[model samples]
Target chain A: MSEQGYHVAILGATGAVGTRIIEQLENSNINVASLKPLASKHSAGKTVTFNGQTVEIEEATPESFEGIDIVLASAGGAVSKELLPEAVKRGAVCVDNTSAFRMDENVPLVVPEVNADQLKNHHGIIANPNCSTIQMMVALEPIRRKYGLKQIITSTYQAASGSGQAAIDELIEQVKTYVKGEEMSADIMPVKSDKKHFPLAFNLLPQIDVFEEDGYSHEEWKMIHETKKIMKNDMNDTELKVTATCVRVPVVIGHGESVYFEMDNQDVTADDIKELLSHSPGVIVEDNPAEQLYPQPLTAEGKRETFVGRIRPDKENPGAFNMWIVSDNLLKGAAWNTVQIAEELVKRRLIK
Target chain B: MSEQGYHVAILGATGAVGTRIIEQLENSNINVASLKPLASKHSAGKTVTFNGQTVEIEEATPESFEGIDIVLASAGGAVSKELLPEAVKRGAVCVDNTSAFRMDENVPLVVPEVNADQLKNHHGIIANPNCSTIQMMVALEPIRRKYGLKQIITSTYQAASGSGQAAIDELIEQVKTYVKGEEMSADIMPVKSDKKHFPLAFNLLPQIDVFEEDGYSHEEWKMIHETKKIMKNDMNDTELKVTATCVRVPVVIGHGESVYFEMDNQDVTADDIKELLSHSPGVIVEDNPAEQLYPQPLTAEGKRETFVGRIRPDKENPGAFNMWIVSDNLLKGAAWNTVQIAEELVKRRLIK
Candidate 1:
């Protein structure tokens, strides 16, 4: 496999979801055989071009994962709780995208279209899930596999680059001091370590990440426990549910949810969940309603799919539904869902 | 009522919820014996100052309600369906803020803190309701009179001045053409006789009004038939339900809802609905999560009460809850809930 196609690294390579996880692993299919980048000693040597090489970044410690077989990280939950177990003890299989080892339990949070077979239960990190719970789990895990979901609630609209890139440069300096009528400076957003710091440009910030004692907000408890551990099945279902209310809207790079859900089979509709999210896999429907065409975050910003639509139904709540997702919260909510779980761990060989 | 105290008339007086209903009837108690502003002959003569005198606008018609005793009518639903029943055939008792007689059957719709006794069952127009259903009925009518609502499911976050003042001057000229990067214009917004015109400043516009045909949005079927007719009461509850999705953020004022409800008594909690919306009446809780507090939209913009907070309880739905409301969609959702229903039709004399 060394004809040159999988050495990776990337930790927080010049931030903002690490330069879109190096432009979603250069339009993915994984093969990069060497592109380290790391970051955070004031972005080490600062440089990052990737697939047309330029690389540089370098400061993440624990010896920047020796022979780097694949990492990716995102660098914040305490630098992925200290260098993702030192790059899983040097064997290097990371993926993270922060919230540290996502509810640990042997960490496999993933969202390769809602749990890509939980990447054979990764022990070498994996995590990823919250860019508002990976676009509401790639638009409700294909309507919970042809209808059976149970409950959802969401209400995000999230975007000021999910609080990074300096909260989208403080929401474009609070929309240019609210259009030069001055005084609109807020240090960061709803929660950059809380203690009050509002002004999200044309405002609306129902806190995202940092409250958690039951008033929910560690981004609404990571979209209610990473959506019940990526919609756990095998009837370990633990009765689905999920709740969120994340907010932070002054959009900048897509992230508009507004779900609603509820299914457990009530004879679904809304055009059968908009024809099952227009054929699932990283969803796209973009509903039509006489062509006003739904799914917008300014036309899903530098899109990478997941653009669902106002697939209505819940008028008075029958089988329920309500949709209107959108994506690109730094690409499919956090660098193409962590480079799509490292391109499904390099197409199932589980990343050697 | 004429000791210089009752001939109101502001029907879209130089627009934007009729100059905040002439600064909420100069901060209420209704005593304004003569303020007649009217409008639409392209804002007629255009003057507009009010209490400090000035006046001018006029041009409405039906001889501009001859001896007008009260009309308020926000000039739009075809000029409040042609001058609110000709200002109720000149005797005048209107209130409408336009959806032109909300679901009509005698028009009462009011939301004076959840239907001020349906304003003594109004017959000559009372309506007001939708500024996202009068701030989710002042933050869920004291949790539906202490635990018995049954079901909600909102998700608004409205405000481009709820599509009025030229959609808040087209959301501040599309946020100054999106921070000067440009190409940001859009006609009026999610709706203004919808034919698509997205670009809600920093963005997000999941249709606010106009779609209606079982895909909701006529501002979500006026928040599901005006919350079962302003929380109806009596066994006439007609199965509570409600539902919405509204959206149109890039706030220029307020409206933030996110609800989730469901009560009809499953033994409610979150401190019995935050000590009953902190003793109800125009609610103002502002929840405290260790001081990051809650109700946002830039601190509930130009407040007029209704600022509720992230109430909680629904970690996985047990009687269900989840709050966060906010207000000022043109003050208490449309100019102090249409001058608090014309000051409860002047303390219940039920108008002229």
Candidate 2:
């Protein structure tokens, strides 16, 4: 850590999220004295532009983080589990964009807007929450602050990009096949490593990630547990119950969520929730049904803000509300969120 | 009204659902001696093949049903409101696939699998429930019968075909635009006559129909109200509270729903639900996680049965469960359902 800005490293620098992290850093106000981009051996020697300078991605290893002050890792959970620890041992404060350390008792899962203060609690690594959970938290945190939240049931319309570059490329190829009247082939959706791969072009995959305990997909487990861990930290009294159904849609970017939530306060109204989110940090409320304005994936693509709309109370349940939340899965859900945490670390001086 | 066969008239025969109704009737075991394919003047004189004979589409007028014993209507809500009553007056029992008579006290909203008994109560017009509602009732009716039902919170992944043939074509056009790297121009989806239109290819439109009371779209309202009407007739004790968030995705056919329900029987397990559905009428259970088997829209397209899968008990809440239900929106949701009602009417000797 230097007074003349910190030495930074972008692990997984040649990947989709890693590439975005570099661009976000260049666009952001983060003053970087030096930048080192690191990826797997296959991606090493490839170059990516950071702050207008082409930085060569080096092979990621234990010594890759020797003099690095801040390390941003998104090379997958296994990579983060192995390399992020080594980086941490080398005196680097890492903000990991994988689930490797999210539920770790020591690592704080931070969505800067909702729980930036938790950065002070990180034990060398601050875990970034899942893409779906991060956006839901960004939109709900504002409302949860004003109206006491008790329960949440969310159904996600996730984009193909959340699976990484290959899935998006497969989706595009599938569309090409669909237009040509050929059967679209699939080897990369729902879960690439799973037994079956279905075509997501103009279709939906209800399963995201492999099946976990009790028939719930691992993606669902992440959403269910991550929400509890992130929310219960700041909240001390009420028990917040959460459930989720994670689905992968055909979109190349932007994840849309249909969230139904119940509040402890019975009198909370849609207008009250909308007005509050409009003023909250990192959230943009676009709800106006009369004009047919609402959050959509295409509109929110590549954006840094979480777009919230369709705020309405459940007609049958008094204290409950339903809303649609959309955000760029790679950006707000991954890169922008990761970058935000890095900025928070600098501002709070939590890192070296 | 003859013993040889009933004369069947397909109002709006040229439409997506209307065409399917004609096909369903041809594929059904119902005895049909003659076929009258009626549509607007625009589609008049268009030829449709039925029962191996070519039939010319006639303009749907009040007099179109004079010699018809049974009429299947799906032109539009307004067309049904104006012409269906006229057909009824002509002594043609009509099964309507529009919203005009669904809630009418005189008309019984029927999904024969769930409420065939209600079909006997229809005063001339039997309303086919909304496509989304039809599939949901088919899956849950069996569950409600065995395990006492209390509440439902559903989020839908609806297809563009639900808006009719034009929207489906628009979605294709939008997909073509997306592949060519051009901005997709959309003017059909969400709702044709609504204030705004958004592209559904590789994207999601949160608004399904025009916004109704409490910011819920008319589509959501239909799912809410129609579900209650069809479910309450069978069971009288428990109040079924239903709420929905209906979204239009890029798919051309099939609608998928994420349903969360609380059963009155606390100990109902996923195996119990899956076992019950496997034997349920007009329902298919495909819930195997290890093989990545579940109800997906692509596989459900063109199928008559409602496919249920991903049945899992809520990990956090006892007595609650989450499931995924998918069915061809045109067939099971509209055409096949209407045809089944026609068959039931004949079987019960209630028609003519």
Candidate 3:
């Protein structure tokens, strides 16, 4: 490996996840020779700090990827659809944080701890799983390897930050209004472009994304599809049954999930599940109930690891179990996952 | 109908839900001969305002029910368990807001919109369903009555107020700390006395109540069990499967749910579901995708009716449908539900 760092470009550099990627890279061991921040025309010319230096955001285009060794894309699906191929075409290895390439046959959707080996088969581009799926997989992968997973049902308590910066601002404003005994207003959040904005400061919103053809919201669909993509290797001829109910809460940063699963084997106890998760990479266990130890979003804010707690066997179903998982949505869910992939690329010598 | 209102007693009169009950009863047409506000010994000397008059808080006791025609109880489960039966024995009709008697076979669980007829069988006590279940049932009951319901899967986005006042205070303090870039402390919420508090200002917490034997939290279990108790015409039939994931969010007031259900009958379109909800009593349908109209917590805050939106069919299951439901947690979820039962008691002329 050369002492000189790799030339890296961050697409969607103005997004919530993009900012985290910059923070992760700032303290990372990876040597960065040059940093390129790219976004839409609206964000072009905006300056972002990287490694203590300001980098001007440029309009993302095919030519912008030339000479870049690794590209981290956190743009939306449409942007990634248009720009990701261009980055790959310019000979840069791409790690996309959008839903565009997650289920693509050629792309490997990876969570470093869960399936770092999948990186070996990536065809120039890798996809990050959905934010909700990423945290669940991080906690469940270790259990799956040890106990063998059969089915998983999860309900997500997602934060406003999962939507974007504007949503976070709206929550703050709404909360202030609530405290001041003033009428609160919400125009963005739980699907901003959606007709009515509800005050999330002191309330909950059930729909996370737009509704698809089926009754499920797009967010719920993402969890269902992304879980399959992440755990694809574990599924044999049988399809992985992943049922999810995704909801948006007043929380601004972290995402929490209540996950229930059935194991192929019944001997695995809740204690065993807790032990496995405690030692799993990038996972923290806080499941002692006597002293009331547990993982919470309040404690998970700004942290990189996924927190697991409340592990117990399902009393009604012999082989079924339940667990709680929490993590900073912007970190492990998006930015940190992308940076971890970048780190793995350096370790595996996948990037020049 | 008596021109003079009955004597009313409010237990846990200063609580989150209790406060809403006072607000609702203020403009109510129900004749009130006298108002008695009862609390614990600690708060016995305190005072709460009711309809422009300062009502002294009296110590809650078995004797407190004397001369009371209707007692609305919102204290903790223990308090309700201890005082409710006493209130009933003393000739006061008890409308309990706690989970104490929800599953008691002798007690008839009521969600007025869904099973107003159940009030006929109440033997001095009527149980209110869980907040999450209440809103979902209100929205789905109309469809279920017409289509013959089969199964339901739901996830809840609950507010801090559901956990009581300490949680609300924690959220406010934490948000202020977060805005100032300072580390915040967590002493309450996501389960008070639980080791390690997380910041609620910008996070999601999956654990609502303490974990039960089958990996489900007590809160989730309540939703599942209460739904059956409220909807089952025959208590012996356990075939009405309802699975729930209950989570606590940073929101302070409204409770939201993402619900999916499959009907015994098919051919029901999302529009049909919307039509059913639109006409349901105590339900307001706001679903319109193109113009971005949908139910949101912010909009639902302070509103008595349950708001339903995002109606769509599940692509995977032909007869299945999905929708979003939101309501003020303190109102319909607790206070309003309790007060409605009291109103029902009068309408039936059940109160002797």
- DockQ: which candidate is best? 2
Write the residue-wise lDDT of candidate 3 on A1-352 in tens digits: 2357788999988888898999988877789999999998999999999878988999998999988889999888898898888888888999999988888889989999989998988888999988998999999888777878776767778888898888888887876776677898778876777665666676666677886655567888888777777787432324456667777777777888878777888888777777777789999998776555677776787899999887776544567776778899999999999999989988988775
Write model 3 residue lDDT over B1-352, tens digit each, in one string: 2346789999999888888888877766667788899999999989988878999999999999988899989988899999988998989988899988998988889998888898888899998888887888898878877997776767677788888877888888887776667987887867775555556666666677776655677888888777777777432564565667676766777887877677988898888777777778999998766555667666787888999887776554568766778898888998898898888888888887
Q: Write the per-residue lDDT of candidate 1 for residues B170-230, one digit (tens) a residue.
A: 8887788777787986887877766768778888888877786666667787787777877
How large is the interface RMSD of each prediction? 9.5, 1.5, 3.4
Please provide TM-scores, in order, for all candidate models, with all chains considered together: 0.39, 0.98, 0.86
How many steric overlaps are in each model, in order? 4, 0, 15
Categorize the docking of model 3.
acceptable
Model 1: what TM-score? 0.39
Q: Which candidate is the best by lDDT?
A: 2
Q: Please, what are the lDDT tens digits per residue for candidate 1 over residues A1-352? A: 3677788888878878888889878999887878888888987987878668786887888887988888888878887897789888988888888887788888888888766887997888888878878888888887787777877888888888887899898888888877888888787786777777878887787887788777787878777777877777322455777777778888888888888888888877788778777888878897887788888877778878878887877645578777878888888888888888888888999877
* DockQ-based CAPRI category assigned to the predicted complex of candidate 1: acceptable
Evaluating just chain A, the predictions reach TM-scores of: 0.36, 0.97, 0.95
CA lDDT, candidate 1, residue A250? 84
Q: Local error of candidate 1 at A42, Å? A: 33
